[model samples]
Target: MEKDFKEYITPPVMLVVLLLAISLIFVFPVLNMIILGAILAYGIRPIARIIQSKLKFESISIILAMIAVLVPLILLIAYIVSVVSGVLTDFLASNPNFDINAVLTQASVYVPQLSPDNISTTIGDIAKYVANYLVGKIGSIANISLDLFILICSVFYFVKDGDKCYNFIKSFVPDDHIEFFDKTVESVENVLKSIFYGHFLTSVIIGIFGAIGYTLLGYPYGIFLGVITGILQLIPIFGPWPIYWALAINDAFNGNYPRVAVVLLFGFFLSWVDMYIRPAISSHHADIHPLILLVGFLAGPLVYGIVGFIVGPLILGITYVVLDSFRKELTESK
Candidate 1:
């Protein structure tokens, strides 16, 4: 009885406890940054290897690869920020009084609850609340900056020493479970590559087309709206419908019926493209189910925040693959 207790209960319990403690100590604090880094690392590793082969310096290749990934992202963010700022400034400058009363009066026709008498007080209170909330979020900027720094460092390390890191992780697994680990790793890489490349390329294509459509329709801030539409495309099911529909309503409100029709038709076309193109790209590469991708896309942002968009689907795919592998192994054994 003592020997059996030592062999089964004690060792397993101790291992579980140790793992829990270690994870709590190391993972909880930087989990988001780690996930972001891992995703970027996996995506950029091949490019880094290609550069390294030519340059003969691993560190230089990794840095160049990081730059290749980050430069366009930085430029896009800057452009979006400038567009938003200009739009806001123009609105405020044009409407010196910024008539909340007129807006509320118009809104009350639809909402039926917004009284013009209370509009001033209600808008004031809401504005104050928003300002306060934004101010509070400002405090987190430092933490976000720190996380970004950590992400860059982690990505560099991952690209530079990915093999060493893999081997180190592999050492922790039991010999009997090594094959499981290897299979999981392969499946994860395939899923991530499919998701990152396939989905991103599709979004970019839709965004460019949406931008062209909006521009042709003489929409204000068309580029900004197009970029937003592209970003929204990352969210499965939701896609760019919300933005396009809102634009259509705006056009209808302004008595631009023809433009509204164009917007609606263009939006529907984009939706169709998404439904068809996304699956073809993802399936051609990873062969993952559309439902799995959808769940991951929706749940990732909800659970993990913005970065969760990528990591969420990835975790789901990995889990599915790992479970499928286990099922096959068990069946073979039986």
Candidate 2:
């Protein structure tokens, strides 16, 4: 016991602690990018592996997989941002507060850099920064550069060496704690799937349905409205309700009472479907509480910027599962 205490306060350990603190201080700024990259790599790995199976070059496969996954995503998000900015610009001049109908008509959308989707995230506050960044109003090009570099590198490395990384971490675990560790890892995986299904996948499903419904109703930008609804769905607290309600309000103001009723009923259906769909998709997973994810979505951006939308929820989910795992282990022991 004396020897253990002596080692605990030893100079070498103290130095190690000091170095870790210093390293963390340096890492803290770019840490979110690294973390987000790992999260993205989780999805990218399988694609890379499948591509690799067809070709002998692992690096080429990973690159191709990355290009396949990221190029469309980049193009889609770029279009959304470009379209939203154009709408905001054109409408802000006519209506200082910005016209909602203009937004519905002209804007395309969703997610991180972005979101409020992609695990992606935000629409409510997306305008605040996205417009600025997209329009070349941002001051720190170097910071953006660093963030992209770290994100891409981290994704590539994580996809390539994730198993090795896991094994390395596992080596440090005590034998008695091995089972607990494994369970906790499994739980973490479940939590990721839960978020992916509960938020991301649900958002996609809702968006498609919203697009189809809005178009059928003959709204000018029906498809875009559906896309926006899907983004709202990603928000958890808000859903497809806002889009329909907005349209209903617009209809009511224009003396289109019958259409308002129709849209509202459609809105109700959108909200109603969510109840069944979100749970049904997430049923096979960890079933993380909504509060955790909500806090994550709202708070993540504050700490990690837009990427935090997904990161916040995921990190919180991991924490909850770990604690839950610990609780179960402690209970079983008693």
Candidate 3:
């Protein structure tokens, strides 16, 4: 043990370790995006391979796959954020024609504990905070642009050469531990599939269904509400409750009793659809517990911000399976 420690602590090895630490420190700020890019590459790599099989040019295939898959994904996220923020900002901005006082008065009738004046003041404070935050973020446009470029490049290269990276990492694993490494890799893949299909794919399906149902129900901002529902579906605990509940309550306040029952029924249906879709998609994969995902989704944003939504679940799932693999290995070795 002494001999091995001395060998590992040689001058050359010490230099390498020092440089590696510095490199990590340098990239610490945007490490979240870099890690997220690597996770996303797992999904994009398969598509790139399929296209390369037909195109015969690796680089072009990756670019095409990114355009097909990643671009739409980025656009979808941007659209949701921009549209929601814009709509809220516009609605909150004082306009002589719009009377928020009347709406709050009606709301107070149902929830007497909530005074109309207090609600109005709270909402005014929130609107001011959101407006100020948006204005402040505007100054960081360059940083956003830089992160976008890094994410794209990271995905592209990771897709094109992920095998090389995998092999490079595997080379460092001792022969006796190769089995453990392989099991961990398999676990990682399963986690990715579980998240991509169970969370994201299901979100898309629910969102589309919501848009259609709300439009049919004749809500004013039906499509917007549907998009919000779909986004809500990504959070395991939230599901579609907020959107449908708000609609139902609004209908009730307006004395539309029949429509209230109809919307509530539709909301329950959406919730039921989620129960079916998540298990059906996730079962064949890692079959991670809902509680694990719930914790990940809730805690991830606090740590990693927006990208945490994707990174949090994947990281937790991967970590869970990796530890499980290690436990099995330890038992078998005994």
Q: Against the true structure, what is each candidate's TM-score?
A: 0.83, 0.81, 0.85
Candidate 3 segments whose C-alpha is farther than 4 A from its true place: 74-98, 102-120, 215-224
- Lowest lDDT 10-residue stretch of candidate 2: 111-120
Model 3 per-residue lDDT tens digits across residues 251-275: 9989999999999999999989999
**Scored by CA lDDT, what does every candidate get?**
0.86, 0.85, 0.88
Of 1 and 2, the candidate ranking higher by lDDT: 1
> How much is 308 displaced in model 3, in angstroms?
0.8
Give the per-residue lDDT digits (tens) of candidate 1, residues 47-100: 998998999998999999999988999999999999989988999999899987
TM-score-based ranking: 3, 1, 2
Highest TM-score model number: 3
Local accuracy of candidate 2 as per-residue lDDT tens digits, 1-334: 9998887798888999999999999999999999989988888899999999999788999889889988987886786787788777877787787545444434335212322132123453677577777767367778899999999999999999999999999998999999999999899889878887777888888889888988998897666778789888887578888788889999998999999999999888888888888888876898778788789999998988889889999999899989999999999999
Task: For candidate 1, give the lDDT.
Answer: 0.86
Q: Which ten residues in a row have the lowest lDDT in candidate 1?
A: 112-121
Give the distance in Å from residue 257's predicted Cα in candidate 2 to where it truly belongs. 2.1
The count of backbone overlaps in candidate 2 is 8
lDDT of 2 at 225: 79
Model 2 score (lDDT): 0.85
